[model samples]
Target: MVPLSFANQEFTLTTSGALYWPGERALLVADLHLEKSSFYAKHGQMLPPYDSRETLERIALAIRETGARRVFTLGDNFHDSEGSARLEPHAAGMLSALTRATDWVWITGNHDPHMEARAGGEIAEELEIAGMVLRHEAKAGETRPEFSGHFHPRLQISVRKRRIRRPCAVVSTSETSGGRMILPAFGALTGGMDAADPAILAAMQPAERIDAMLPAAGKLVQFPLWRREQNLV
Candidate 1:
């Protein structure tokens, strides 16, 4: 985990794409997409059916690593609205245990917008904490420090003549809105969007600069995507 300061709050970025808030003792993750395999299988696409279990186990490991008493999921908690019903018994048990152990908040997203907290957690459309907005998608005109997901940004770089891609947080800073960050997808089965995509840059608008961040061993790697020019009108 590497320390990152945003919205005047201290946070630790885990290599696994989790944000740990030390002050709140909270663990934040995005786009869990649980039961995604089952959702695909329903449409005649066969995939390994253990995605939910794997995701749940990772969440549990993150909690243990951070000693977090609270958990905030930035949407897409399940693959679909009915995904909760498709969770295997063991995965369901694991989820129940985690929720019971911590204060879990499921921020509704496009995929699971009308989900119920049947696995023992609170449901919310979004959350505000320490002046930072937490949501599933970035509001184009929001003028406050925000943390969100949905883009699943990834940084693709070439090292030693080999292409390497890693999940990353897309962060942008603006004089009006403070700072906004989009977290990488937490689901093992989730796909990634390029961190430098124009759509992503436009979403995090009103920014002086934008960068993709990845936590490495004792350091945070930043790849700048955009920067306001001094001579641009």
Candidate 2:
């Protein structure tokens, strides 16, 4: 884990794509997409059926590492609404244990808008806590400090002639509104969009700068994505 400061709040970013808030003793993860592999197999794609298990294990590890008492899943808790019903016994047991051990809240997303409490967590469309807006997608023209996940932003760069891609958090900072961040997908089977994609940039509008951030070797590395130009009148 590495230290990260956003919207005047200190957080730790885990390599597993989770954010730990020491102040709140909360662990925030985005895009769990549980049972995604099973969903694929339903269409004859034949993916391994252990994605939910792996994802749940990671979340468990994160909780232990952070000693978090609250677990908030930003969105897309499952690949689909019926994902919980298809969970294998072992994975379902793991999820049950975790939820029973903590205060778990599932913030609904586009993929799992109708997700229910059968998964053992409270369901909510969005939340506002400690002056921060938590939601599934970044809303255009939102000025408050916001944290969201949906785009699964990834940083793609050519290093030594080799194209390397890494999951990253895209943060946009504004003079008035503080900052907004799009967290990388935490699911095992999630895909990503370019960090600097126009759609992402546009969603973070009214910003003076945007950057992609990730931890490397216990340090935070930032790659600038966009910067507001001066003297543009």
Candidate 3:
């Protein structure tokens, strides 16, 4: 885990794509997309069916590492609305134990907008805590400190002639209000978008600067993504 400062608050960003907020004793992860493999199988595209178990295990490890008493899943807790019903017994048991261990909140996302509490957590469309907004997708023109998921931003770079892509958090800073951030997807089966994708840049608009961040070798590395053009007098 590496320390990150955003919106004047301290957070720990784990390489596994989980964020731990010490102030709230909370672990925030995005886009679990649980049962994603099952969703694919339903469409005749068979994939390894242990995605949920793996994802849950990762989350469990993060919780243990952080000693977080609360967990807030930014969005897309499941791949589909019916995903909870399809959880294999073992995965289901794992999820149940995790939820029971902490105060869990699942924010609805486009993929799981109708998600319920069947998976042993409270369901919410969004949350406002400590002057920050937590939601599934970042809203353009939002002025508050915001944390969201959906884009699954990743940083792609060439090193020694080899192209490497790693999941990263995209953060936007503004002069007027608390900054905003779009967290990387934590799902085992999830793919990522380029950190500088236009959609992501647009969603973080009304900002002076934006960057993609990830932990590397015990240090936080930042890659500039977008910067507002300055006017010449």
Candidate 4:
């Protein structure tokens, strides 16, 4: 099986919005939005109630596949404060089971500020373990091997005149100390924006390097993260 890029130092990142640090044998995920479908359903969208089940199932499968004994949620692991509350009992049970199997840390996200307190995991605005900064948002005027989420980075690739945008992990090649990485959304229902577009660009250096996980190519592809010529939205 083709594996995603894992940081050589302490934390290894996967294109699936997950990470693996060999030192801790931990699996990291970002923007899970576990009950996203339910959140939409509550607003009368009435999407299938299978979002939670599907998300948990995928995470579980990743754990089993990687043999990871720990799990860390970068942020936005929950759709909203009440999203988990809306979960079907079985869905909640499934999540609990996943947490029970490993050391789970639920970092705070913009949407789920109460995740740590409500969910069965430790809460932290950001964590520094083994020389890496794990946070929800990218810090301003600070650079220390930051690993974060919230950008929901996506890559736009044109395949035969058709432009296809796919959610992806963005790792910076600037820092000497393992650099930075932005995870894609792992939830089944959370919406995302293409990182290749100007509207998606923030303080990003524009000339930075990008590595996109191409499962179809069985390898991470390197690209020049050039400035977006136009904005979409």
Q: What is the C-alpha lDDT profile of model 3 across 1-233, one tens digit per residue?
A: 99999989999999999999999999999999999999999999999999999999999999999999999999999999999999999999999999999999999999999877776989999999899999999999999999999999999989999999999999999997699999999999999999998999999988999999999999999999987874213
* Sort order, lDDT high to low: 3, 2, 1, 4
Q: 71-181, model 2: which lDDT tens digit per residue? A: 989999999988999999999999999999999999999998887777597999999989999999999899999999999999999999999999999999998797999
TM-score of each: 0.97, 0.97, 0.97, 0.85
Q: Which runs in model 4 stand beyond 4 Å of their true positions?
A: 1-15, 116-119, 175-177, 198-201, 205-214, 227-233
Query: What would the per-residue lDDT of candidate 1 be over residues 1-233, giving only the tens digit for each residue?
Result: 89998877899999889999999898999999999999999999999999999989888999999999999999999999899999889999999999999999999899999888889999999999878899999888789999999999999889999999999999998888889999999998999999998899889988889999999878998998999884268
Count backbone clashes in candidate 3. 0
Judged by whole-model lDDT over C-alpha atoms, candidate 1 comes out at: 0.92
Candidate with best lDDT: 3
Report the Cα lDDT for residue 103, model 2: 96
| Per-model lDDT | 0.92, 0.93, 0.95, 0.70
- Model 1 residue 122 lDDT? 96
Which is better, 2 or 4, measured by TM-score? Answer: 2
Candidate 3, position 13, lDDT: 99
